[model samples]
Target: MSAAEVTAMPEGRGGRMTRAQIVNAALALGLIGFGLGAWAMDETFLVTLATKVAILAIAGAGLNLVLGFGGLVSFGHAAYFGLGGYASGILAHHALNYTAMFEWPFVFEGTTSMPVIWLTAMAVGALAALVIGALSLRTTGVYFIMITLAFGQMIFYFAISWPAYGGEDGLPIYVRNGFPGLNTLDPVQFFGLVCVVLFAMLGLISMLARSRFGLALQAARQNRQRLMAVGIRPGGVLLVAFVISGAITALAGALYADLNRFVSPSMLSWHLSGELLVFLILGGTGRLFAPLAGAGLYIALEHLLGGVSDHWQFFFGLLLLGVVLFARGGVIGFLAGGKRHG
Candidate 1:
């Protein structure tokens, strides 16, 4: 290729939007339209259903950052997800009951504010990622995967044993907590809030994927030795990506807990982590909108098959297998007309 040809091509894939991008954007808008339509029809349940999809998509996006872009397969991401839920639940529990979180050098008070709780959750999640990444990044391949899972299980059992937070029974937030000016009790209003965050996170990931850091991370994944030869430390790039990924996932967890008004050990389970991975794979690995598409389809299938039969997951597994074996790029990849390496 000539210099001009090389220069004309944009970073990551190409400067132009991919088929996946176009489809994903349309799907997102469709979701918004559906939510608004449901609100008008007085079908509040549908609005809540859409809101659940948005929240789960956000969580899947968080995992995609590491697994898709960063080339790190973490089987224990539920740790961050659960931590975020616990953060919001614990704070709201205290705030609703009129108790202080702690009385240290300065009095630590609980808050029912959504913004405050989200900030706390993201911070805690990022910290956990930093610690976990520091240790796990020391290894590679299956060892890395196992180390991450071990860290996740450690937190899971800790939460189970902590009696202050209801132990294995779990904790509950009596109310959904307060956002700035909106009446959060209204289904559509709360859905709007979650939608805004979901799109923002999606856009953030889009920009990050095209940035220099994202390029370096992808390069490290493809060839760590080459990246090292170029004077970039692969470990540092992966560590940063992991931290950001955890923060995003945790944010989703907090929102999810608020939506349900409950936080349980199930959120921290390996099953949830596996499900997040499944979402990515079902949509298309490494595609910008894969998480959203995957989450939408997964939720839809669950709602549909669940109502028809008690063993819905058996059918779900068969579908997942079909995708893995026949559909190389997942649903998006199949529709977009190409693989996801781009």
Candidate 2:
């Protein structure tokens, strides 16, 4: 190409890039730059904080499925969250203690593999959801909300009373879990794993929202009678969504347990359940990437504000209240203008 022609070309393209492509390219470049910067900094605290944000984002995304899309408005999701955490902790404990988890007709042993832990967490969470959802789904409006809250409290109390795995004292992971060839003890590798999981979950959620099942679920959420008339069982659809939602949250729980290297009754608390919902509201519900963005911003605010003043949470509460009252769509909706479905 001639020098004159090259000079006349747009920076992003050989000629000129469309607005959409330019925006996407900029975002990709920005993320790459941020990752490179974090790698170079090698700051333990920041990296750890970022991992926490990612984990919280995953939890938020799961909760969003129920609250935002399904319109379930569950207040007891922390039960699944804590269940996933404890599952990992208990398994790791048995493995480290050099004891088999079970020896039935078949042998089962504890494992630190990320994949195994994830599956265990999902299974446990799904089972819990099955029971809770079955009962909770029977009631509608305020009754459903109360039942879910009650179930959450029940699990929390059970965790606190259980003498195993430190009870109220909590269980420590000692070392981060392993992922095949990856050295999870390394901050960057751990962070990368978290990022991969977060993105994967995001992708899964997006695809689910586009699927026919998702359409039916949304319809059931809006009008149960109508969906039933259309030959779709509303309860069944909601039940499936609930299970998937719980499973995703449980995956987050496993990551969280590994992140903190601890699992306590506190993980099962109603307060945590509320916080997960809060993260969804703060980010904007229904949008695919809202949870991730919201979690990142929330953590950043917490870190910055906490460092500035001991009364930061008080002010943070005020900020959240403002968003709830004034910002209808959360931070993402505010930035993006209108709410984007799917």
Backbone clash count for every predicted candidate, in the order shown: 0, 0
lDDT tens string, model 2, 1-342? 111111233334567663333432443344334554677887667777777888888888888777776788899989999999999998888777778888997677788888999999999999999999998999988898889999999999888888866878988888778999999988778878887898788667756665777777667667888998889998888898899999999999999999998999888999888888778777777655557667776777888999999988898899899988998677765765553221
TM-score (C-alpha, index-matched) for candidate 2: 0.89
TM-score, per-candidate, Cα-based: 0.94, 0.89
Name model 2 segments beyond 4 Å from true: 1-36, 340-342
Each candidate's lDDT (Cα)? 0.87, 0.79
lDDT of 1 by residue, 224-247 (tens): 999999999999999999999999
Top model number, lDDT: 1
TM-score of candidate 1 versus the correct structure, residues matched by position: 0.94
Candidate 2, pairs of clashing residues = none
